[model samples]
Each structure stands twice: as structure tokens, then as C-alpha cells.
Target chain A: MSSKKQASSQLRVGDNPLVKWLLVGLTLFLTAILLVVPLIAIFQQAFVEGAAHYFNSLLEADTLHAIGLTLLVAALTVPVNLVFGVMLAWSVTRFEFPGRKLLMTLMDIPFAVSPVVAGLLYLLLYGNNGWIGAWLYEQDIQLMFAWPGIVMVTVFVTCPFVARELIPLMQQQGREDEEAAVILGASGWQLFRRVTLPNIKWALIYGVILTNARAVGEFGAVSVVSGNIRGETNTLPLHVQLQYEDYQAAAAFASASLLAFIALLTLLFKAFIEWRQERQEATL
Target chain B: MSILIEHISKTFGQFQALSPLSLDIQEGEMIGLLGPSGSGKTTLLRIIAGLEGADTGRIQFGDRDVTNLHVRDRRVGFVFQNYALFRHMTVADNVAFGLDVLPRKERPSPSEIKKRVMHLLDMVQLAHLANRFPSQLSGGQKQRIALARALATQPEVLLLDEPFGALDAKVRKELRRWLRGLHEELGFTSVFVTHDQEEALELSDRVVVMSNGYIEQVDKPGDLYASPNSRFVFDFLGNANVFEGKADQGKWLNQQASLQLPKGIEQQDGQLYVRSHEFFVSDAPTEQANLPLKVVAINPIGAEVRLELSPIGWQSKDIWEIDLPHKAFDQHGYEKGQTVFVTPKAGYFFADDLAQPTPLHW
Candidate 1:
């Protein structure tokens, strides 16, 4: 009877015993080597010497400065992306216009283009020798090769996260609730805060988490514009690279562990939000 | 309040959703905008609610001109098809939203808002559900809560977009009756949009039937059903059968079937339309008409026996339907594939050039 049941179940797609085992084995092997090992390796190496050593390396002045600068960049980047993302999603989903489809395509440019290319584009426009940069240089406002440069490139690279997360959700939830609120005498702000925001809270937070994760860990773009100036232009990722190049392997891994920790935290929060959202939908 | 809409029109880029049209809704009147999909009935209702702007028009609520007013400032209570209740808020908060959103000076006190919400909930007979989320309620319960929420601010005009569309049939009928009672008790001017002929006929004091972004007819439900102005309205009302024939010498002719036109209904190139209920089946041809049709199917259920018939000696692209009282059906004992004669007791005749159909009776 059990064998018959198994045969019946195998009638479904991709349920053959050998094929399933092969696929599962391949997936497990690849995940263990490609993802699990590297993640564990970072933490393992960070504390290889001792917890005291790890703390000392992370608490170094340059490392501390790099940490603060990374947090600051994320702080500036997340809010800008959040506002821009909500507006873009709202416009494309709620209203119709000639360029609406084109605008949605344009929003995905940040995701499509290489982060280094994005940084280079910003540098060319805002660097010292470029057209706009020459004018800014005369006014003594430097954007590239400084902390501001890091923030700008990070913003450009992470801009699509919030909007990407929000677009499909807002499209699904639709403009009806907002319309209802407006017809019930809700002002513009009231409509958003009361009707629109509550429906999208989880998605918006998920977007923020993605944006923050990308902003803090962004390397290719930040490298192009940051100039790798230790204690000044250096972010944590840059500092980790510099430390690795200087042959301070343990210290580098210690700093890498911080980014890894944040990534883990982001994953945990994302899972929780997804679970909560599922519960919410089940109740509905 | 009476709503006076003048020359309202809207065009969405290449597609014109609404052409230049107007409607006058009397004070305390419940009007229904009824049409098929994409017929601009919802668009007309949205424009009236100020959820959408009209291209060229003036909207006057009572004596107040509100053509350019924003929806938030219009003070009109609007309910959406899916209830659109705040999912994050409890039913009480959803009901109190309108009162809470009023500008500071005019805003009711927190305690007053609570009392009014409870009172509204009580009126809808869902006061026990005040603490529950909208998700917890059934479709009918949610609909009642939505109505109570809409009434919380005591607006003079209420607009509902396909109010009971998503409910089951029994719930829809119940909600329809409940809404009618509420509308009468409140005495608020109301306009609702629906594609349902039955709902519009049962609930509205006057129904505005639309087709292809234009108003087809506007009249009391009884009058509208009895005399649909155009062919579109006739088809939209459902269960209508048409016989395309030419009229000559006071006789409508198609093949061997001939139906004599009533007095003053003689016209060239007319199409006769008959509702299923308006036609009668007899074992022999009547003096007024001779439409020999073979019974394709007989549905003996409900209050009547419905016959699906195909013509025996006439040409109709579609099959014809006739309904008989069960007693009559039992007496005749009609069966499938049996030849029977059908006479349209009452029908409307639409000519090739005329927009309005002529009512015909034998």
C-alpha cells in the first residue's frame, strides 16, 4: 500500500527517486560549500585568536570610524530610497500616464547596471574635473573621493530595493483603499498615514532592510568613489579590504564578521516579517 | 441634497470613458448607474463623488457648486466594492474614521466619536462586532460595517460603487434590502453603480442605464424594464430574445413565421425583441402570430417551466426562450423536440434608423 502511494505521488512532476535524490544532494553540497562554509569561516576566523583579540581589532580607532561612517551612509541612503520608492510605486501603480511604463523601467536601472558603473557615472558627473563637478569645485563642495561620495554611490546602487519590494504589493492592494479614505474626508497625509501605509508596512520594512543591507555592504560602487582614505573616506567594507591587504587577516575577518552579523540579522527580520504577513493574510 | 450634473465628460487618452452627458438627481433620491463592463457607469459615479474629475462639467450639490472641489473637501460618503475597510484598525476605528478626520475645530470629541460609532454600529445591528477586525467578519457583516462607517460623519450624499457585488446571492439580496431601509431612514441623496439589472431594478428609485460611454435610458425601474429605450438596454436586462424581420403591409415577416404589428408599430426593417416572460407557448398558432418552434429544452423548476426553442419554419440566429406558469406547463405537457407555436404577448420593435424602440402588444 505504501509503495502504491509512493508510485501515485511519483506521478507528479520531478518525483522520481533518483532524480529527486540527485537534485537534493547537489543542492545540499553546493549550499554547504558555497554559502554555509563561507559564512561560518568568517566568524570562525574572526574569533580564531580569541574573543579578546576580535574585540580589540574591531574596537580600533580606524575600524570604529569605518563603522560609524557605514552606519551614517545607510542612515542617509535608506530614507532617500524609501521616499523615492514609495512615490515611484504609487505613481506607476495608481495613475496612468504616457511615460508610466518607461518610468518603471527607469527605476530598475540601479538594479541592472553594475554597481561600479553606477559609481563611475556619479563620479563623472560630480567629480572634480567633470562638468557639474567643476562648478561644485569652484563653490568648494566636494562630492567624490569623500564620505559624501560614498553616500552618493551607495544611494544610487541601493535606490531600487524599497521600490522593487513595494511595487507589486501596492499593485495588488490597489488604489481602492486610498480612494475610500479620500472620499471619507482624509487629506493627502491622512490618506497615506492611515490607509496606504498600514497595508504596506511589512513590505516597506522589508525594502528598508534590503536597502540597509545593500547600503552597508556595498563595495564595488563605494570603492570607485571613496578613494579608500583610512579613517576619513574609508567605510567598514573598505577598511576590511585595507586590513586584508596589510596582512592583518584576523582583524579583517573580525570586521567582516560585523557585516555578516548584520546580514544574518536582516535575514532573521525578513523571515519574521514574512511570517507575520502570512499570519495577517490568513486572518484576512 | 439634489445633485445637478451638467455636461460631464471624461476622456482617458485614446479612449473616451465618458462622453459629454448630464444627469439631475433629485434630493433624497437613490439613483443607480447600471451598465455592462466599460460602459462608464462607474466613471460617472466616480465623477459625481469627486474621486475623478470631469473634463468639462459643473456639479451642484443642492445649491452648492462643487465641480472643482477635491474629494476630501466634498463631504460625500463613498463605499468601495470590497468594503475597503482599514485592515489594521478594528471595526470601531473604521467607523470612526470620518469623524476623526474632520478638521480640528469641527472634529468631534473622542468620546462623541466613540458614541456615534457605537450608535452607527447599533443601527447596522453589528454593535457586537465593534471590537473585531474587518477580516473577522463575513462579507455581509463587512458590508454592514462599511455602511455604518460611511454614515458616521452624517454626510448629505452617499456613493457606493458596486455595493453588494462580491457577496453571495442571498447576502446580496439581504444587503440590498438593508441599504434601501438605511437610505430611506437617513434621507441622504445616494448614487450607486452596478452592472446588475436585478439589483438596480429592485433598489433604485431611478436607474440610469448606460452603454458605450453614453446614457442609454434613465427612468423608474418599472418603466425602464417595461420600455427599454434602445436595443442595448433590452439586451443588458437579460433573457431577451430577438427576431430580425422586415415589416410590410402591417405584417412582420421572416420566412414562414409572420407576426402582425400592432397599431402604429408598422415600420420598415424592424427587429422584434421579446422577454422570455412576455412570450407564450401554445399548441396551435394564434391569430396575432405564427412562430412555429421545436422545443430544444424544457427547464421545469422554480415558479415556471422555461422552454428553450429553435424555430421550425423561421430563421433566428439565436434560439428563443419562453416561460410558462407551472400549472399551464403541466396542463400542456410539452416535451423536447415537440413542435409548438409561440406568440409574443408583449415586445419592443426597434427599427434600423431609430434609437428608441416602439413597444408592441398583441
Candidate 2:
């Protein structure tokens, strides 16, 4: 008992040895079973036949096209969500108006609703038979059952990440610095460039990273809207499912492995950016 | 430049933040907008700086109507309460921001801008920390840098919202003296908002006291101190002990306690306000006065010894506090639980619902 007392610092709460070991043991055990094992299984199954088979499966035309289409959707969706997210965050944080609280509550809709439901909603609203889509169909435009539909649903599901990361930060920093800049005779553009942009740049970057990660990995929403087209509309995750359903387990695992690798990279970027922002605030 | 404000008022939603009011400020004079929070002092300062527009009336800066001008075009310097030095910029860059943002046709050359920033830095006496980011500087240093940044464009008017409010007492005092000196040297029209009465009295050439969105009084510091026009001003300016009673045969009495009203005062029921330094404590009640209090606490640590007393027979809203000079306290050798009679040397008496207080002295 004396030894245990000496081992634990007084500053810490929940300092019982048995409780501490139980919590740590449960966390590590659950992580290995739920997360680590699945990640390892993806790579093992992908290379089970042989490294040559795994590489050849990845090099197939449909797989390559899926990868290309996923990248394009992410590239397009990220910038669209980035602009929309920043504008949403900036408006909610910086301005006061009627229905502002309602607007803010509305921003969280994508985050709360199921991604598949979000996709279905978009399909109902923007499909060829849908109200707005009927007009666009006459003009020979197709948003659903295509790459544009995939990108649209992807953008919807990913829009909140950037805005969610930024609102608290911008609110904490407050409008004092911007007001000071304005009083110092800075034009609107200059105030944003010289004052507002620099402070929020790190959080902005962090948000963009999360948005990209979600765009690349989104499956449920993209599935409902994508129509499962083979080479033209299949994203990485949708392609993985198509491969598995076609009895190509190795190809499915290979595609899933690529997603796991991207997720790992995104985590690394997120950690580094969080550390940079911590240092920035510590200095302040 | 002189500033003339006419019938300026503002409302947010349903709350009237400021009532229509007007004042003229002379060039090179320093004015303090003194009021408690929600009294609209900060709102008025922001309005004058063009950071917030008044819902009605016009503002003129020496004959130029600035009522419709954007904050950026008003040509006034403003220092925020938090200093608001750009967190990402070094001290030099912060001070240079005002000059750097000027239109190219009017902007100074880079070398000239650098020199001007350095000169302002030297003026604030922290030129050596020019390379340090705002976070690296102390609170007092950051405040000076904020001032230098505000002054960089050489605007003819300066506005500050609680300039030294974030600093410790010692730092606040030091900066108050420094800012006053800078104001004298620059000779610009200056206005600052502060709820700290000592800051207002010590630093302002004149103080404008406001309450509930109304201007209560505007006078030189000494005159304002001597003659507060309303109850809000009287209570806000200092710690005061109040005497509530009715006049009977020239003596104002509450319960068994009563005191003679000075001659030439008409008979009326009202509350009397007295400062701690304006009354004296003695062993027995005089024929003209009887105010009995028991000392509950004695603190002898500061400039004067302080005593916390409670009324013996009369009623008071709070515990009465009285200050005594150390020499007198030592001579009297007062102790806790000792009863004493207090007599008023002077006070301001307000009649029922009267706006002005009648000054009384003995």
C-alpha cells in the first residue's frame, strides 16, 4: 500500500492500481481486436496469393480507374467543402443577425444524420426525376448515378469537418484583432489577409486535412448516389465492395489496404498540425 | 483635431444602449468616459471611433462630417482592452501594420516605414524587444506595443477602451503615468473609457460620468469630485456611508439616532451621503449629533487605518466602513467591539426623488 502510494502522483485522479491496470488493459485489448486486427487482416489477405498477384490486381484497368475517380472526387470535393466550410464558420462566428442561431444549428445536420440517409436525400432532391434535377435533365445534365452525384454526396458528408474545427477557435480569438486592424485604416481585404487569415490558418489547414480524409474514405453516402457504375463511377470503397462481390477477395483487400494507408497518413498529419496549433496557443 | 458629437444614440434589439446625448471635445484635451458596465461608455467610445455607428445624429471631426465614414476612413487610432496586438506579428511588424496597409499612393516607402516604426518603438522604450512576438512580451509591454501601433499613422485623435485594465495594479499605475505623458507630448484629442474612478480622476483632464445610458455629469476631475450631480455619480465615485432619516425641528432622525441639519437647509426627508474622511468618531454623542456604531473589524495596513463598523440602533443597507488616520487611531487606541459616536463634518443631502443633491457642511 505504501509502495502504491509512492508510485502515484497526488495530482492524478483515478489513481488506484487495480482501476488503472483494468482501464489500460481494456483499452489496449479493445483496440487490438476492433482496429489493429482488421487493419492487419487487410494487408495479409491482399498479399496471401503473392506480392505479384497483389500488385497485378491493383494495376487492373477497373481498379486503376476507380482509384483515379476517387482521387478526382476528393480533389474536387475538398476545395468545394473548404470554401463552404470557411464561409460557414466565418459567418457564424463573426456576425450577428436574425436566424443566425438557426443557421448554426442547420450546419450540424450533415454530422448528425446517417451518411446513407444524406445520400438518399441528395438523390431525392437532385436525381433526374427530382424537382430541380428535372429542369437540369432537359439541359442534358446528370448529377445522380454518376461521378458528379458521388462528388455531391461526398461534399455533403465532409462539409462539417472544417467548419466544426474552426468555429470554437475563431470564437475564442474574438474580433478584437480585426476591429483593431479596421480602426488602423486597413481595407476589408487587407484586414483579412494581414490579420484574420494568419491566426486561423493552422486550424483551417487541419480542417482541410480531415475533409480530405473523409472524402476519400466515405462509402455509405457515395454508394447510394454512385449507382455502382464499373469504371466510371466506382470510388475506392465502392470498388472494394464490387471486387468482393465478384469473388475477387485479393483485389478487395488490396483496395482496402490503400485506404488504410491513406487513413494512417491523415492521422499523422492531424497529429503534427495539432501539436503546431498547441505551440501557437501556448505562446499566446 | 476637435470633435463635436450631436444627439448620438444607439439601440441593439430592444435594449437602448445609449440615449441621445451630445458633447464637444477640445483639441489636445484628454477625456475619460467613466461608467460602470452596461452604462454605455464603451459603446459611446466605439461610436466615436466609428467602430459602431450611432443610430441617429452626426459626428464631426473639426467640421468634416464623419457620421457616414467607415471605421477605416475615420482616421482615428484605437487601442482595445486586450491590447489586440496581432498574435502572429512581432512588435515591429505590429507597429508597422498601420503604415503598411495605406494605399500605395499614400503609403510611405519601406525604409521610411521602418524608421517610423523604430522611432515609435523607441518612444515607448521597448525598441530592444522589436523582434519578439506579442506573446513573448509582458502584458505591460504588449499594451505599449498596442499604443505604438495605434499611433503609427499619426492620427489627430486617439481612443482607448480600458487601456490598462488587464494589467496588475503596479503596472496599471506605471502605464497610466506613461500614457498621460505621451498624450501631453503628442497633443492630440484623446478619449478613454474606464470604470476605475481613480484612473479617471488621475489621468483625465475632464471626466464625463454616465449611467443608464444618460450623461450624469461632465466636469474637471476636481469639480466632479467635489460636486457629483446625481446619486449614481456619488455612489460610483467612492465608498460612501449613507444616512436615511426624516427632519424634525431641524434635526434629521432615524430610530433613536439623529443629527442636526446644517443651517439654511429646508426641512425634508432624504438620504445623506458622507465620505469616510469627512466624519469623526468620538467617545460620547454631542448635543448636535448622535450616531452610535460598534467597531467590528480593524485593518491598519495601508495609508490609513480602516475600521468596519455596524450601526447600534439605526439601520443601514450594509456594514458601515470608516477610515481613521494612523496617528489618531494610535492615540485613541481603538479596539474591536468598542462603541463610538460619529459626527458628520460634511455631506450631500438628497430630497425625495430629487435629481440634485444639496451640499451641507459644518
RMSD of each: 2.3, 1.9
Model 1 Cα shift for residue B134 (angstroms) = 1.2
* Candidate 2: pairs in clash: none
lDDT by residue for model 1 over B111-220, one digit each (tens)? 98898899999999999998999999999999889888888888999999999899999999988998999899989999999999999999999999998889999999
TM-score of chain A of each: 0.95, 0.94
Model 2 chain B weakest 10-residue run by lDDT: B299-308
Task: Go through the candidates in order and give each one's C-alpha lDDT.
Answer: 0.91, 0.93
- Per-residue lDDT value at A216 in model 1: 93
Reference interface contacts recovered per candidate:
0.90, 0.94
Instruction: Spell out the clash pairs found in candidate 1.
Output: none
Once fitted onto the true fold, the runs of candidate 1 whose alpha carbons sit more than 4 angstroms away are A1-13, B248-250, B261-268, B284-288
Per-residue lDDT over B212-311 for candidate 2, one digit per residue giving the tens place of the 0 to 100 score: 8889999999999999989899999987899998989999999989999898999999999999888888999987789999999999868899889999
Best by TM-score: 2
Interface RMSD of 1: 0.9
